[model samples]
Target chain A: MKRIRTAVQIIFTIFTNGYAYGFLRGKIYQGNLKYACVPGLNCYSCPGAVGSCPLGALQALLNRRGFQVPFAMLGFFFLFGSLFGRFICGWLCPFGLVQDLLHKIPLSRKRKRLPFHHILKYGKYVVLICLVGAGSLFLFGGFAKVPAFCKYLCPSGTLFGALPLLASNEALRDQAGGLFSWKLGILIVLLILSVKVYRPFCQYLCPLGAIYGWFNRFSLVQVHWEKERCISCGACQRACPVDLAPEEISRSAECIRCGKCAAACPEGCLHFSKKPGPNPDTKPDLKPEKRT
Target chain B: MNVMNQWNQKGGSRQHGSRGWLFGLLVGAAFLCIGGIRGELAVIWQKAVMICMECIGIG
Candidate 1:
């Protein structure tokens, strides 16, 4: 599953940003194909990115020449969020893929689960609503030249877009100043955190994940629970890379739908349910069938 | 928990589940409709064609 997921990630990364030679030319792709938006987060400034980043597009809408509300971009967000939920984060996002790979590096301390991790899950939603949603309209609406998130915080812009541009273009180095250093600092911190934590950015910062997570309750694709299956041995929780409980599989907004928990269940109690189950109870251990 | 249950009671899990796809379709259709009218595709195209130097922090 990991192999397949990695392959899918690679394919998506390539398909979205395939213009590899653009770095050498120090030119971004200026083709008509740029109009479309991909489901996952990829920087619009990425020389190879064929599609626009939704966050950037949303921010772009705020300062657009004619002050349009960007219904089309919002529509894309609604459509993707409602359909697949965080499945895009699990399987498609290049940034997610990078974090997953970074996490594989050998750590002797055995990955300390942050104490307030679950509580921090709500942070992404705040970022989505405040930074991505409102900040664009308020700050950028005032004719602030740059989108708030991209200019201030997005590490993907720094890693995939800015760094590559800086490396290839000699003239760009002289232009680097306080903001570049600040963004680079953020990118470095996130890179180190990715090594120590499982998708730290996805858990606490990604606005895209926050949007998709809200749709998880309603998404057609979700992890199903089989109440009648065997013992509730804590294997699934132990196996979960993101450390999600088996019961919280699809119910919690934190679930990435990575299928690690389903694979680790010894009793085969968990499976991806296309249709929603009738169970009202959210807790796995308290289920009536398990009691019986 | 009472408030939560009341919220849950308003929509059964099955109905809630189905609403997911229904809402998705409706929103997707709405986006396409508005996009067509606003010529949002052109907006996206124009943004894409222009190098966002500010995004890269060069400007």
Candidate 2:
């Protein structure tokens, strides 16, 4: 299952960023497909990206000269959130793939949870509300629009868009200034942290993750937990990459549905289901089966 | 009677959940069409094609 997910991630990454010429020439794809938004944190400015970043599009629309609402981008978010929730993060996002790969590197101590993990989880919501929402809408100077999150904090843009563009284009390299340095520093720190911590960005900082998380409870696909089959063992929680106890918080907003918990369950209590209800065969009074 | 009531309640909730999902899809589609009619897709295209220096954190 993990291998299948990795293959899907790699395939989707390539499919979304398949413009070979763009990478060679240090130019973004200027085709009509750029108008369509991908359901992940890909940067539109990426040399090989064929679709727009939904967060970037939202900010751009909000920062437009007039006070026009970004109805289409909101709709895009709504549709994707309702359908997949953070399953996109687990299986589609290129940066998530990057972090997943980075976390596999040999480390003395790989921490499952970061410092202040509980308090820090709310930071992404703050970013969603402030940087992506209000900062783009209200903090722009007259006649100039600002994509606050993309401009100030997005490491994905720095890694996939800026670094590649600068690598090929000497003019863009020369144009790099303090802002570029700052964003690059952020990228480096996040990448380094990824080696030790599991998906620091997704757990704490991604506005896109925060958006998708809101739909976890009602999304079309979900990690369903059969309460009757749970044996009170903590194996699922221990195996969870993001430290969520799937048996207790079956519909938790923070669950990315990576199936780590499901994979770890010895009793087959946790499973993915399309329908939002208890198992038809559930026997509430059934005894917990002992696992060999 | 109690078991029947519980089963009926579960069935109703499941039906409600499906309805909510369909309603969400409909709402999303409606807003998408409205935005397209208002030329939002073109606006997105214009922004995306242009090299957003700020987005790259270069400026």
lDDT score at residue B20, model 2, on the 0-100 scale: 51
Clashes of 1: 1
DockQ for every model, please.
0.59, 0.39
Q: Could you list the CA RMSD of all candidates, in the order they appear?
A: 2.7, 4.8
lDDT of 1 at A162: 90
Q: What is the C-alpha lDDT of each candidate?
A: 0.78, 0.84
TM-score of chain B of each: 0.61, 0.67
DockQ, prediction 2: 0.39
Residue pairs with backbone overlap in model 1: A17-A48
Q: What is the per-residue lDDT of model 1 for residues A1-292, given as tens digits with 9 covering 90 to 100?
A: 6678789888989888899788787668887777778888888888788888888887777656546778888788778877788989999899999998898898634453666876887888888777776666666433464477777788888888898878887787679888888888988998898888888899899998888887887788888777667367778788787777665676667888888877888778787777754445545554334443
True contacts kept of each: 0.57, 0.61
Q: Show where candidate 2 strays beyond 4 Å.
A: A277-292, B1-16
* TM per prediction: 0.91, 0.91
- Candidate 1 docking classification: medium
Chain A vs native chain A, TM-score per candidate? 0.92, 0.94
